[model samples]
Target chain A: QQQVKQSPQSLIVQKGGISIINCAYENTAFDYFPWYQQFPGKGPALLIAIRPDVSEKKEGRFTISFNKSAKQFSLHIMDSQPGDSATYFCAAITGNQFYFGTGTSLTVIP
Target chain B: SQTIHQWPATLVQPVGSPLSLECTVEGTSNPNLYWYRQAAGRGLQLLFYSVGIGQISSEVPQNLSASRPQDRQFILSSKKLLLSDSGFYLCAWSMLAGFYNEQFFGPGTRLTVL
Candidate 1:
């Protein structure tokens, strides 16, 4: 069974526009949510993460909005740039294991 | 700073050939280790994890197996590789169960079973 679900397998956004990716989880035990960005031929790098205690967390151009009741979270990228084109993955940690949602491929067109 | 290493950035092997992939971590001890595989255009799949030396927990039952002979070394092996085993492999390490601990991954290794 897929524990975490992500929407929009692929997305294209204009440069300087907002790029958003949403994800949902079924397990309420999850306490930590993290997003990872991976470029072609490169390992995934942690982007931004949010704990359930906070409703929102922002860092520079990246922000993570979380809803604990709905078990949903989203990543919003402000001023999207062409260099931001990459695959994004959202993962949740319950206990010691992490479960990842299906990835989203985002392309910021200049 | 902590770093992870995986050998043979890319490999192409014939079917039925034995395979071995190695991963090691530096600047840390008694870390929780993990092995993950990703297919083209797919999400990462957890394959194996080890919390300490000689302790391994497998997430999937496949032709592959994993071993941790030392505190910082993890190995993935297969007696006879299958064509479907082609994918990118990643190794990660995290501080043992604690608050706000995050995993750090290696450069990754790409293996193609021909």
Candidate 2:
């Protein structure tokens, strides 16, 4: 069973526009939520993370909007650029194990 | 600073061949190690994890097995490779056994089972 569900298996956005990807989790015990960005032939790197205590956390142009009551979190990329095109994954960590959502492939057209 | 290393950036092996993939971490002691496999068009799948030396916990029932032969060293080995085992393998390490929750990943190894 997939503990976390992510919507819009793939996304396409124009440059200078906003790109949003959302995820929902069923595990209440999951406390830490993180987003990872992965490109072809490379490891997934940490992009942004947020805890349930905070409603939102932003780093530069990337923002994570978390809804604790709804058990959902979303990533919003501002001024989307072609370089930002990559696979974004939402993960929930419980104990030492991490449960990952399927993944969303984002494409920013130039 | 911590560094995680995974060798043989890419491998091509025929079916029924033995396989070995190695991962090591530097500058950390007794880290929680993990092995994850990513198949085509699929999310990362946890295969095994270890909290200490000589300890391993398998998350899935498969032809692969993991071992922590020494501290900071984790190995994934298969007695005989299966075509379904072909995928991108990643190694990750966290500070402790439980939820202190940041995992640093290695560059990853791509294995092709022909």
Candidate 3:
């Protein structure tokens, strides 16, 4: 069974628009939540992370909104650009293992 | 700074052929190492992880196996290749202090079994 589930396996947005990717988890023990952005033929890179202690965390145009009670987290990309097109993965770490969602493919049309 | 290295960025093999892929980490000691496989249109699947030298935990059963002979070196091996093994392999490391709260990954190796 997949411990973490992500919605909207694919997304398309226009330039200067917003792109949202969401994920939900079943394990309450999970504390650290991180989102990774991966380009084709490259390794996934850390995008933004948020803990349950905070409801939201933002870096530049990227923001992570986490809801502890609902056990959901979402990534919002403001002013989406063509370069923002890539695959995004949301992961939850518990103990020494990490559970990652399937993934979301984002496309930003200029 | 810490960095991870994976060898033979790409590989092609035939059925029943032997396979070996190597991964190494720099600027850290006794790091928790992991091996993950990404299949087409699928999520990153954890294969094996090691917290110390000569120790490994397998998450899935397959023809693949892993070994950690040294603190910073990890190797994935297979006695015979299978067509289903074709995919992207990623190596990652995490500091034990954080207990896997954060991890870094290697560039990944693309394997094609024909």
Please provide, for model 1 over B36-110, each residue's C-alpha lDDT reduced to its tens digit, 9 standing for 90 to 100: 999998889999999999999999999999999999999999999999999999998888467866677888899
Q: Ten consecutive residues with minimal summed lDDT in candidate 3 chain B?
A: B94-103
* TM-score of decoy 2: 0.96
Error of 2 at B17 (Å): 0.5
lDDT of 2 by residue, A7-44 (tens): 78999999999999999998899989999999877778
Where does model 2 sit among the CAPRI classes?
Answer: medium
Model 3 lDDT at residue A68: 94
Between prediction 2 and prediction 3, the one with superior TM-score is 3
Candidate 1, DockQ score (0 to 1): 0.70
- The 10 consecutive residues of candidate 2 chain B with the worst lDDT sum are B95-104
Residue range with the least summed lDDT across 10 consecutive positions in model 3 chain A:
A91-100
Error of 3 at A59 (Å): 0.6
Which of candidates 1 and 3 reaches a greater DockQ?
Answer: 3
Per-residue CA lDDT of model 3 for B1-114, tens digit only, reads 999999879999999999999999999989999999998766798999999999999999999999999999999999999999999999999885852357788999999999
Decoy 1 TM-score against native: 0.97
Q: Model 3 residue A83 lDDT?
A: 99
Q: What is the C-alpha interface RMSD of model 3? A: 1.1
**Regions of model 1 farther than 4 Å from truth:** none
